[model samples]
Target: MAKQYVRKKEEVLQTTVTSIRHNEYYNMQKMFDELYEKSSKNESFESLMPIILSKENILLAYRNIKTNGGSITPGTDKISIKDLKSLSSEEIIENVRHIVTGKRGYNPRAVRRKDIPKPNGETRPLGIPCMWDRLIQQCIKQVMEPICEAKFSNHSYGFRPGRSTENAIAELEKYNVYSNLHYVIEFDIKGFFDNVDHKKLIKQIWALGIHDKQLIYVIKQILSAPIMLPNGEKIRPLKGTPQGGIISPLLANIVLNELDHWIESQWENNPVAYKYSVRMNKNGSENKGSGYRAMKKTKLKEMYIVRYADDFRIVCRNKKDSVNIKIAVTKWLKDRLNLDISEEKTKIVNIEKQYCDFLGFKIGLKHKRGKFVTESHVADKNLARETEKLKKQIKRIAHPADDKDAATQTYRYNSMVMGMQNYYQHASHVNKDFAIVAWKINDLLLHELKPSRQKGRLARKGRELTPMEKERYGKSKTIRYDSMTGIPIYPIGYVQTKAPSNFKRGKTPYTEEGRKMMHKDLSINTTLMHELMKQTVHGSIEYADNRISLFSAQHGKCAITGVEFRDVNEIHCHHKIPKSQGGTDEYQNLMLVLNEVHILLHATSNETIQKYSELLQLDPKQKVKLNKYRKLIGLETI
Candidate 1:
């Protein structure tokens, strides 16, 4: 009243309850019925939803308007036909516009939805698509299909759409096409999950006409789903975002199937349709020049899909096929699904002779040679020299404490031998390089024993030598016995040492009380000597008389011929019946004779001895001659 006496009427915008009410329930019921029918036909859940929602624009618009708000006002007021006819066209248009703009009622407020916060405190709403990832996935899926078809048949192993890219690359190289292809195109889908067009995906699935409970579950997940984190944070994954999730593999598989189908369709009408038939040529030796001879036509049927999670590798017969496949896939994604491709990361290369790295493996052709060639540089020369020096040092020591210590010191040597053997075995089934040379030093020392003094005519009295001289002489004569054997020994080059003997005697040098003080000192010397002796006399014989080689034919006259040839210094014992002729070394077989005569008698035939010596050489006849000789020499014989 203070500003003006008259004021223009204010218009208010308002919404009736009926305007907010939706036919969503009815539409959803219809969809459910269709899905049920599809399910009855055994269609998959992913292939059922799109058909039901194809004409439900009203429902979608309602959802969008509810969440984003709009200016449409709802009312039941009626206008008379006479009033409408009285109004001009401009007035009617203005009135209709006002109604549509909601100028006559209270405006409704937009619904506010809570956003999930990331680790960095950034908030994001669910159901957004990532533009970059979609492009990459499309690109990869397009590139791989033709190559797979060419390399493998429908019945081949790993023919699924989700086959490993590495395997696909290898199969291509096996066909000898990878090297000719120089440029490689790689594709990656950026933010695939965040950018997914759920509606489009549903349409695609529905177009397939499959229906199942799984589809319902997927739909529920697509709407109002929550992802729980270890840190107690909850998030809702966006529709097209590709990331870690239980449903990721399934979704990725779905995408791959679509891409595979698209690629196959494109190839059906292409100029390279003939090339697809060449897969049959994979059989026979004639295909060797093309690298397909080893591959069986039957076996080639199974290599279609190559998938490693979200990454894809599409195989094609030629570069043109690869590029065309990419273009077709890109068009399908962009025109049908509103997705984009990332060209920067997409590359095409020839992987025929070399390996194509995928999922941490370098996969390439399976050559007839089938050998792996590495491109790493040889080991440093300094390191090799150092290793060789260490090997020499290890070779010098014969015995080590344990195998572990020995292995540590001689690692290079052992590795060399084993590696050579392994290499040969791999190359030719023979292990000729496994030879090892073992060496040991055997030091043999010799010593001689000299009598302390001379006897009889050879005796030298006062000249027996003093203690000091004796000590000097003993030391001079004290040849160091073999370190191995107690007897005088000599080294004969390098020989393996014998295992130490078990003396079997419990001998201790120290007294019970003194044991504690001298135990170690006394035991060491004895143990060392025992060990040396054990090693030295390991094969030699021992006797009490110390007269080694007691039996000798050197003395011409035998002991039995002593009395008969008393003046003769040479003598030998004779056997009436030679030992070789069943004779024994008993008194009856004993006879004395000159060395020459004994030899002569032995040289005579056994028949001669039996006929002549047996009678003429009888004990009494031999005793009479022996007595005459003995009397002349002042000796008695019997």
Candidate 2:
């Protein structure tokens, strides 16, 4: 257990923390915004060296990397954030600056590779970069992002600064309610990130008005960095951005942006296919004098797309258009980017007849109260997976004599349930579906948590009740063990539903102020009370998470006097088992109580106890629990 941990509830609820920047960095951002604004308005640039190599920008990148959570993982260099922390600020800035300025010829090391378990029980590879290299990449990403963002299509929403899965999902559902477009074309690119053509990507960067020769050479170098696999084998890839690199998402988006533009042209701009409908000039923009904008002011678009990374869905007004557009897109991807679409995975479905899966939500039509409407719900696969997962966890507790007690198991189980509910709270029938899941899962809980009644059950438990003996408990859903611990278990459907958020309208990403408005998170919708309610935090708990966990364990009261904590400043974490006596960092050894109580517990003289006399006054129950806690730590009770 840690000595202490604390944080404001408000901080955890925010969608994102504002990037901490120095005063000088603010001016640099303004300059970057101005340059990016020019490129967005059809300007060209031959040099970005002045901005990229500036000392202020260099320092800012270093600061941001230090703040970033991923900086801890080491690359092939075997230097982590811990090593960087050992150096002075000036020393680190100089080291990063030398590499960026070509003073040391900028040799990038291979990425450290590891695999993580997926939700569906599969594994995916991840690349970890050293802090030094991440600093250089961050320098380029911060500047390049604003410039690319201006020219990037509004429909391409992956890895963008202000965009998220929620925005993309909302856009997908918008066409459902606003238009008669019921046909959907879903396509998966065959190894999108792994097969991205380096030549084609470079051309796209040039097309975006960034033509810095030196910078381009450096980016190419980064793309060619070798991969150090788990088995001590190193492989150099000719194509594909490694999944875990800092700039991989931006690089992938640049490759996909080309696809976004070509699709937009065929759907809205190019007149060869829609000559009978509208007239257009050579450039993709509409001809204002030709009444092109006015003619279709009230008309719904026949085709459009919403893309996140490699996943995309094309919606059309009719099945004929859907099939044609799908063919056109397949040909276009091969010709323009030299990539192939997965024929086996791709399909065109009439959404009105059957639903399509996108971003974990089922998008299709629903007949409700005499009207047919489009709505998204949790996929059946996810519900089945979660149900089976709970059953397995309950079985471990019931049959096996594991190290974990009933109280610890109950807290962890509840935490897992709360996290799942938080993710799917936006689904339309989530409450209804989860109620069914809860009904099934709670039975498993009741079976394990309740003491056994059979003859064999008593011997297995070491001490238990018989069939003739009786016991009292709360509602069937609530699991309990004793006066303390074994918290009530709630299920997925417990959380209230939250509506999806609409994107910032009429604001372009080119300007500094416009980007500011787009980045604002005014909604305070996340509820973390259940996250805090867990009596024990599993695995290695973060400092903030430990504070929240112990706060729940205390029930927000001073353990000695049983008084509610009026302010967070008064709360303190006490060690139940002293470190000198061989207590480790495991969370079970710590307790949250009042500052006065913690000081009195460590008091060596009678005068010290008398100094905190008011706080020492406890009722019979508090005195008993206090003495119990004291005995564990080898101390005498006041």
Candidate 3:
């Protein structure tokens, strides 16, 4: 009976493959000709296809199967990873290779609908790609990653290599610094993943010059095939590219690239307004004493759009342009791509009217020392909401009556806390309000350890600890607790709220231990600060702590004069390039100098600064800062 079942499945697969081969929808000749044309221009589609295809082997298939983990839900064929693993590794690899080579038919994917809870108490359908189907998708993704990485725009920060939510937010913040920002349009596509027009997506992929035969065939099947819902109902979607598959994001990005291109084209005609320079003197106004410096002029479009997956934030210089942009983009998505724009979700607001929120950060333009800089803060409301949600979840899992072990409870708690922290790290890094939230969450984590009140002889306030007690305890901040189990629970850790430095205790909000703890909590490496400071010290680097550290590291002495300054009031932070020429507050472009030396450096020619730097006999660190500064000012560095 089992042999008969296996034979029947093989017969069906053979028929499917035959149909795929004879499917006249794709023009093989045209695909080949296009590949040949692309081959002439550097590394082309065809040139790389072989390498991508060759990578499908037994080891990878086995690894992906093992990594797929527990759900093991079956596809349309009712074959799960458990069933697939029943076969030998060689057999599994051969089957996958055959499918990849178009010798076997692409299996119909089964859709398992998962209800993902949203912030507003609404749930959305997340389509779970089937076990076998996901395995194939993983293989395709591994091969296609390197080939696709370079093709996407830098403005896009979704699921691309070396890009992330932070990068996207940072770019948006950079734009906000210009101060000409008039309106921000937060655009949304209705049912973004589920509403993708399959045919339209295919055309967009072709437009991107991706026409590899196997690749196209796999995509077509993925898009056009019917999905079997859990209720034993098989439905073929009329338009949408299925939501929860590996290929879905890649496909969506390809379609959205068209929108990016359209935006860039329109910008050639719509230039932004220019205003007075934000660069300032110690008194917080442009240094008019140097000479009559002209304000920076703008020639490019005064508008830009940034996207992450389906979310888009468009910035424009004026209301007229904002309205026009929203209309154009709406029409373009509808007419060109057959995509629906969510009218309710598409919002345009004056930057002066209200702050724009995207990817969880509240973005607004703030006037800092007469210059406008983008101010980003995590919403207190959001942090509170997440904290409450986490409390509810932790209570359910770590119930007093539950039999779960400490390790299991700890694992669950860590996952929830880490995920929340990562999402809110940018805001948490600056928001003092986050400490309250963290304290509450820490209390929950403490309870999970089943700790009781500490029962020990306590010393009164102002009494010194015994010598043995002092020897037994170091300076780690901890909470003492007696445990229900024989082992006592140690301190429950809290997120550090400051950066550490060598400055006096009250000088800055950061401390050495606090900075290290903060970095660990944020999952950021200290090397990032070191790397930024290691480069030529400039104002373009916006991180103030590292800039101050660079100055302190150099012993508060003017790099040129080698004169020590006991008071920060005597020092000036100078921009390598004058504000009139588009210099920014980045660390690489800023330097601390004596107030007199600063005035001389700005008043004199670039040639004189270069000569001064040479005669000053700068140390290695100072030399790097001077060289970067010289490069910005178009002077030859020694």
Candidate 4:
């Protein structure tokens, strides 16, 4: 028995040794593959294939980085953007060239990952790409974007350049112009990006006209390279591209476009009809004023299958056609692409009889006045999802102590809310239902801006404090502003503007000195705040959105002056009763005026200003400010 046990132990030891040797051989094979790739550099352009990954391409890539936020994280190499930017232009070029050419073996160093929550309460792993890796990927993407854009079908909008959900929505809405009995089938691929079969994806790309051997070699090497996880364990992905990589979206689009082409081919023999009617002016052509004129009769059957990334919507004539197409598509996906259909999500519904939720819109036909009109409204689930995200962002922005930063946050918050509203604005319930919700959110945000009532106030002993004492108390006291729900907080400052209304906020004139003082007081950082404050009013998003609506409604012409607002700076909002005269903040009493007209009204006497104000149909208040410029320029009151 002892002899048998010893023999068994020896056998186990031999097996372990063999396994270790096998792994070593496998790792060495990866190195050999890279070496072979390097050796092929001497080959002709015909053999090597030209690509944007070369040294000459780094300039445009660098420019894009600089134009972008230029944000970067310390990777495994411990290199950050600051370190990269510190180098001379020539040195930066050399460094990028070496990295792309794989002087050192290319392996992406992954950062700590956090799971992002989905609307369905499930979480998916999200990896942060190293800065160096991102730069390299960005360079590659610059090369690929235009090529993909030209080749990709206009119907496939997901992750492509200049395409958005709204674009896809607009394309889909084209069918809605006419009342047609269409069966809607929408589905998604299960774990689309995460479970992508690399070999199949590459093959599809090759079939789609990518014959570049060098690019292919680089892709294969990167895909095969081992990635270091957050826990410091290095593991190679078996299949599928990681989500964080910049090239992932482009590659995914390339693969999906093949699927789109195949589906299109299948529908050619049996085309489905999409009917719509556009309202034409008395002229022969469409009316330019009405952006997308409601049509009387239009047919668009070319887009039977509309795709945006993994989300797909197929319009068919009947249940039989829908089921047949779904089966064919699902079978092809499983058999050829090795991708699974999201069974629970894949469904067909008669949209004419019942509403089907597609890409956050509840789409159906509404019968009114003996006509069936296609109607789409914001889905309750999508609105709830967006609102939840907005709440979290608001909580984060509200926590900072600086009022300017808080204002900047408010601007961002309002922009996000407006973006949502833009998509849902055409919905029937938006004005009545969503508007109330938006107002309540604004009230909540305004309440946050006010000093927190939760903190204790300082009081004097046995006496009511005088105005002087109260002023001193206010100046001396400091209260801590705790962030809500433990959201991350950062101080953000508003971008100081030189608009005519800037003077109205305080006592200073809208001059260079006043602008400098405003900048100093706010501690404005132009680099950080410039893009964030574009089209915003003093960093107020709500104010900017309101102004935009008024500008559009009034057709870029001043209501009072009848002058075209060629520049946004020339436009101004005036109150019927000045705030100094105890006017309330009401929309009905507000009027749009030219900047010059506003200054003229404020500088002149109440009697003089009232004459023209009445002519302009404005309720002129008995409030005026003596203008120093009026006397300097010898200007008379209107």
Candidate 5:
């Protein structure tokens, strides 16, 4: 038989004496003598071991002394352990004093007496020797022991083995690899940490033969340690520690595995074969008469506990089977370990049809055709609304200057409009169109102070004034006020004493270059109208020169009606002509119209003009008339 390496208590005491002597400390002789005597009494030498080992330098010196024995002499030029141990108390005290005061040729290993420099370069005394180290030692005694004791029954379960099983199940489900229809169930154990039974844990630790001192220290650390939350709240662990810690999952899995074993033994004795079998087919064809035929049935022959730190997933089959299993597990934990489930955190959800979110992974049902659906479709209507509102607000605040703001607003508006156009692509419940419209309105407000490109002159010429336009033109420009603060801003320029002749004659303001300049001064008022009518008309006279070239691209024709123009200058871009007639400055509303015909159409009622415009179907009356003339020459029409 191999020799048993028994460590005697007396040997430990001797080791301590040797360690103290090697440090060349004189006053410790009495302390060493007292420790030896205490060890002989057999009255708990373990309690004093930590105090003796507390000084790192002394321990290191003792180790050196033990390693190099007789080769070291007492009082030779070289200092040695024998010299330290053989010296009288008075002699050793004197040497210690000399070393401390740096009088006996300064020992480099001795604690330096230099002042600690402040941040500002000023020096101060090195306060209290290793105060934190001493406190840590004391804290270790009070904390680590109790924690270890409470955690005695805990064991670690590595991820390698568990992940292999999970992956196997997934692959088997993929190729219909298993003969049986695969079913997975997941359950949560609530209030796991807070309900840990400290007393039971301590008893288990004692059963393992761990000393009381170590157990006490571990328990104290668990009780005293504080956890900081993301919201700045500090939480102290109550029953058990958080599951996110490195060792928590393994420990929790081991405890739950024990509970599972106990439950299985009980079920076997009771012989609830019918219940177990029924659970397996709860959602299967066997339950056709149970008013749940649409749901597939599954058998529950087994259960497993999967743990990621504190989060526990109890996977099983059949509702009744799962419920019974949960009840048994809960009871076992409560009776034996005093652990309770957190009802609020615990949830029972369909593992296959809907996803179960556990340990940051989402697991869901697999289709009969072998497609695995792992993601849950979560519709957060409020969140979407808030996000859209924030986006609009950000766009508004990002570029507030009127000139720069206009393009940004237009871009946002166009993007929203496009989304509405593609609204069918989104889920029916999303309200994508509504969101887009809301964003459009926000864009309008952001660019309220900006100017718009003027419509071509010909399209506006000869257009009659509507009652709304008359009122708008007649009303004096009032000082605009801030919507939020209600602070008024003075108008930049004075309103003209006389209305322009272009307004009276039904001619577009773009008839003369000088008139275009005058209109630029009035852009603040006309720009809003221009944007509103952009949905209907092509030309705006407010800022015409810059836009004239673009209008000529389509030969000054109405894009929708295919109305062509003979005199390019005579074809003016119309707002589908709405200053306020429920029209907006969108491309769909814009059309090229003959200047005179446009004026005539506006002079007529909207219903009457719409009828005529629809009849011609060409660019304007001039184009239609010209076509009729050509046909007459060709003998095609009268």
Candidate 6:
């Protein structure tokens, strides 16, 4: 049912798992801040090359690209980060410089084309950028991110740092719950990533003062790069950036930001959101945006929009405004971005009888406390699909194995369940949904572990129990594993209200500490990290086993940096070809490296190498080895 819901989005299958993810600049945060300040006040920039090509900026850019997903995905040249680890730091940095500076030419290689199955049984195309192109894209992205952040809508959540689907949902709630909005205009621009107009996007970028000719030349080339399909057929794009490129989302946002601004001008900005806003105090309430009498006299109807990537929703207090805004938005996108809002998915519905799906949430109006409140539930279709996926995963991994293998299986099982929990931690019914799923998984695990079909008490008992179990469950039992190794079904008892988010949303990322906050924000789902360890999404025991063996083989030293890893999280099992960009997970593919060193090995950024060398007090020889691995994994060597 979930997959079947969006029936008309055919062209999107040609892009990567691209719609889903964003934020930040580091070290050069202040420099970017200055750009943001200038841009916020509507000024143009020239001669940004020094900062963009500066050793530090390039290093930080690589840092972001390497640590984030996609460092491993190959481009037209069929080169990925794995191929770049041998480059010395100077060689890598010089490579990025040459690409952007036109020393080696700014032309990007063709995208290595691929497709992955979407939940809807449709395949999504992945235009994977080469390591070199990816690095340069990030280099450009880092410079442009802060400037763009200065101008992006608070309502725009896609690809920006700190903003998320939940945040977008919360904004929807503000209009639906706090206000009297009743009608929903829900729609997504079909094939938005694939259809972005190159000329218009560049004009928008220049408008933002990102007018560096060389930089502009590089981006134009990236945009113009061809998509190489599986049969080696190349499709040169006249519009739109590749879905997997680091800059694709930013470009899409920039292109659609025009849509954001136009709509805001009509409703949010032209009159300003507060043109008809309200507020209250402890003792009294006030219509601060306007007096009650003026609000009554005014002919304005309030409209609010919340957007994440290509998908967006416009809410209004009446059908007339909703319909009008929808019509206006349709025209705006066609006229501005030259994209079409999907008629199948885009509908204006009353809150009482119908609802719209956004970011895996079922959003509609709920009558609460004698009033209708805009509320979201974990969509039934999503729960059903996720539970099905969980059941299938359990079928594969929930074996009745003996000894440490049981412990390992238990760890694998918990990771899957926990990942699901974390992915929905921001849900209003996280507790309830997790309970239902966990119970089913628990029952299924017990069934799989039993040597034979056991009835009644035996079935419930679940193998021989230890003293800790008896104390916990008395006569009845839950699934059991090695005494020291595994856990029962993880409890889903915590309430995850949409409490105030500490994240500053669009304002974070390119700011100094925002990158850390962005990483923290994005880390709500660590399961993806493990799932990303391989292409087919295997259980991580093999990966884990390799990490243990490699650590012992090296006596716990990082393979590249040869430094001691103090933290467990720092112990990364890197695929010599990283799974982040789609590497396979065989024993031969494994490498034990500390997280920081892992960055260098799969690196796009150079800050850590510089910082680590100073902190660990490495000699020239050791430092060279570190930089050798620092060869920005995205471009030269890749």
The candidate maximizing lDDT is 2
Q: List the pairs of residues colliding in candidate 2.
A: 1-585
Per-model TM-score versus the true fold? 0.29, 0.71, 0.59, 0.58, 0.29, 0.74
Better of 1 and 3 by lDDT: 3
Query: What's the lDDT for residue 620 in model 2?
Result: 78
Output the better candidate (3/6) by TM-score.
6
Query: Considering summed lDDT, which 10 consecutive residues are worst modelled in model 5?
Result: 1-10
Evaluate all candidate structures by whole-model CA lDDT and list the values in order. 0.32, 0.64, 0.52, 0.51, 0.36, 0.61
| Runs of candidate 4 exceeding 4 Å displacement | 1-51, 54-56, 73-78, 102-107, 110-112, 176-181, 269-303, 389-400, 426-429, 442-638
Encode model 5's per-residue lDDT on 514-553: one tens digit a residue. 2233233221122222223223222333223122222434
Q: Summarize candidate 6's per-residue lDDT along 289-335 as a digit string, tens digits.
A: 55433544556656777887777888887877788778877988898
lDDT of 3 by residue, 112-143 (tens): 65566666677666666766667777656644
RMSD of each: 43.9, 11.3, 21.6, 21.2, 35.0, 9.5
Global fold similarity of model 1 (TM-score): 0.29
Error of 4 at 334 (Å): 0.9
Off by over 4 Å in 3: 1-58, 61-65, 68-87, 100-104, 178-182, 268-301, 393-404, 428-430, 436-482, 485-638
| Global lDDT of model 6 | 0.61
**Model 1 stretches astray by more than 4 angstroms:** 1-172, 175-184, 213-218, 222-224, 228-235, 241-244, 268-305, 316-328, 352-355, 363-638
- Among all windows of ten consecutive residues in candidate 3, which has the lowest summed lDDT? 1-10
TM-score of 6: 0.74
Error of 6 at 58 (Å): 2.1
Model 2 lDDT tens row, 50-89: 6776766776676666655567777888888778767765
lDDT over C-alpha atoms for residue 256 of model 1? 49
